[model samples]
Target: MASRSRLHVAVFLAPAVLVYTAVMIWPLFNTLRLSLYVEADGVRSFAGLANFATLFGDPRWSEAFWNALGNNFWFFVVHMLVQNPIGVALAAILSHPRLRFAALYRSAIFIPTILSFVIVGFAWKLILSPIWGIAPGILDAVGLKALFAPWLGREEYALTTLALISVWQFVGIPMMLIYAALLSIPEEILEAGEIDGITGWSAFWRIKLPLILPSIGIISILTFVGNFNAFDLIYAAQGALAGPDFSTDILGTFLYRTFFGFQLQLGDPHMGSAIATAMFAIILAGVCIYLFAIQTRMRRYQF
Candidate 1:
């Protein structure tokens, strides 16, 4: 019976394991392998770390790489500072005991998350366009017309504007996660807090916040991974070039341009793989830091 049960378990797990290996593990290792090689005049050769050195040493590659890296950092920072806090605040409000139409509000807020990146990007682009957008008219109605600009066109505001649009689309994810975390808190603990004169903001700060640290940490890591891997929205909105002079260029766009070769530039798979490898390293490092430094210190509050 023990041997039969073990066989059954293996049979169940085999398909998933095979699929994961084929789709994820294989591609990842292949990309890493490609990164260690270089091509010259159609002849490929082992280059070891030469490609990486060129990526950082050559001005042509290094300038674009560093610019994309910096933009990616800022993209993540905006999501952390703006998206998570707003999500938390929305979750807190929606979780209120006597709030009316709470279900409707929750559903409405989460609507954007289900929409495609292409739709969100184009929709916002049209709405923000200076030539024929509704945003300027709306701002004019509110007596704030001067605040409006061609946000997606100008280099100064393009990256930040795109980041904000991304934030709007994905805020519901953190809201839902944090909402579930808030709901998991014991009613007895909250009641006891009330008895100790800890209600409203004080109750949230003193009693509830500590328990939800794990959820927040998870959300942060997810945001880090997603932001770093982001491509579709930027591509949809700004094209592969990521212009107005590549102001919104990020690692994903950089990889796309390198891999496929945009107008006037020849595609270089080896260099593209190098960029991918770098991105993987960055994401892995962030996850490791979060797991070791942040997650280890968080106490898992039990009911």
Candidate 2:
């Protein structure tokens, strides 16, 4: 009977394993292989690390690559410092026992997340348009009209503005995850804390926060992956150029522009693959750090 059960389990797993191998593992290795080769005069030849050397050493490619990478880092930072903390606060507030309309509030806050990237991008663009935008009018109403400008059209503010827009759209994800974590805490633990005179803010800080560390870690990792892989919103709003002097460009848009020839530049799959490989390396390194540094150090509390 044990042998029969084992056979059944193997059968159940086989199809999933095969699908994962075919769809994910194979394509990943293929891309990695492509990154090591170059096409010259309509012929593909193994170029070793030549492609990577050119990517880093060549002036034209290296500048754009570094620019996009830097922008991506800043993008990730904004989400980490602003979005996550705001989400945590909102989740804490909504999780209160006496809070009214909590579900309605959650759904309302989460509505933007469900909208398509195309929609959000275009909507925001229209709203922020300097010539005919409502932003100026709204600012005028609040007597802050002097602060209004074409934020998306300027090099200095474009990236930061887009990052904030992205944060506004996705804040709900962290909020929901943290909210669920907060709700999962055992009432008995809180009761004990109350008995010990640990109430309200003190109870949350000492008792609740530690238990939710794992969830926060997970949310952080997810945010890292998603922000690094982001493309659609930027493309939809700013075009392939990631304009205002390419200030809004990130790794994803850079990869796209590199992979598929943009404007006068011809497509080079080898270089595109190198960019992708680099991205894979970065994301892998982040996950490893989280797994080894953060996850291992976090003490998992049991109810």
Candidate 3:
């Protein structure tokens, strides 16, 4: 009977595992393999690790590589600082037992997340434009017109502004995930805490927050991966150059530019492959650290 049950489980899991391996795992392995080769004149040659060596040692490649990598890190940091906290706060409020119009609030908050990246990017651009944007006009109405500036066009503010915009659109995901985690906690647990004189903020701090640590950790890792892979928004708003002097340039856009060529620079697949490999390595290291270090230590409590 136990053998039969095991077979049943395998039967159900086999198709998903097969599809995942074929679609995701195989392509990743092939890309890693390609990263070890150099392509010239439509011919492929095994370059061992020379591609990686040049990627770090060569001046032309290293500068953009480091800059994009640094920008990506800051992008992830901004999301952690702004998006996660806002999501948690909203989730907490939404989870309140007596809250009205909860469904409507959830739908409205999540609507932006479901929109295509191109739509969100263009919409924000129009709204932030200097000539006819509503943002400056709204600020003027509120007696803060002096605060308005072409933040998207300035080198110093462009990346930060874009990061904030990305956060605004995506916070709904974390909010929903955290809210669901909160709801999964049994009412008996809250009742027990209340019975012992715990209530409000005190109850949440002592009882709820600790239990949601695992969910928060997952959200953090997801934000890290997503931020590092971000390209569409930056491309749509700032173009492939990530301009106003490439201040918003990140690894994804940089890789794209390297692969396809832009203006004076010729496209080089070998270099692009090297950059992609570096990104994959970075993401792999992060995932390993989270899984083996942080995840091993985190215990989700049962209600």
Candidate 4:
């Protein structure tokens, strides 16, 4: 009977396994294999870890690699610091039973999340453009015209500007996730908290916040993965060069530039694969840490 049950499970799992292997597993294996080979003098050969060495040791490659990594970290940080907090706040507000027009507000916030990357990037580029953009006019109306600068064109401001744009585009994801989590909290638990004099902000802080920790953790990890994988918007706005002077280059763009030819260098699939492997390692490590260390502690707070 046990053998029959196991066979039943295998039969059900086989199709998904085959599809996963074809799409995800096979591509990952090929990338790893490609990462271990190098081309030299019109010949390609197994290079073991030499590609990784070059990625770190050679300044030409290492400098750009480090820069992209740092920029990527900043991008992630911006989302965590600005995006998630606002999402939680918005979710808290919208979850209120008496809040007026909540569905309309939710739909409006969420619409941007579904927009095409190119459209968002292109529209923002036009909005921020100095010559014809409305930003300066709006600032002028608000008596802060001097505050308006070429945000996307400046090295110091470009990444942050793009990060904020990204935040605007996707903040609704965490909001919706948190909203669902908030809604899932049993009324009895909330009533008990109320019986203890917990109400308003007190109720949210003592009751709702703790219950939603797991959802927030999931959202955080999702944000980490999504931000690390981000390339489309940056590419759409900045192109492959990621200019002004590669200020906004993240790992995805870096990998793209290395994997495909840019103005400066011919495509090097091996190095590109190495960069991809590194990105995988970083994301894997981060997820593992969250699952093992942080999540274990968070579970103690789970009711």
CA-lDDT, candidates in order: 0.95, 0.94, 0.92, 0.95
| lDDT, model 2, position 58 | 99
lDDT of 2: 0.94
Off by over 4 Å in 1: 1-5
Q: In terms of lDDT, which candidate is stronger, 1 or 2?
A: 1
The residue ranges of model 4 lying beyond 4 angstroms of the native Cα positions read 3-5, 300-303
TM-score of 4: 0.97
Taking the tens digit of each residue's C-alpha lDDT, what string does model 2 give over 173-246?
Answer: 99999999999999999999999999999988999899888999999999999999999989999999999899
Sum up the clashes in candidate 1.
0
Q: Higher lDDT: candidate 2 or 3? A: 2
Lowest-sum lDDT 10-residue window in model 1: 1-10
TM-scores for candidates 1 onward, in order: 0.97, 0.97, 0.94, 0.97
Please list all clashing residue pairs in model 3, or write none if there are none: none
What is candidate 4's lDDT per residue for 1-303, written digit by digit as tens? 555556777999999999999999999989989999999998999999999999999999999999999999999999999999999999999999999999999999999999999999999999999999999999999999999999999999999999999999999999999999999888988898889899999899988998898999999999999999999999999999999999999999999999997997899999999999999999999999999999988853435
Model 2 scores a TM of 0.97
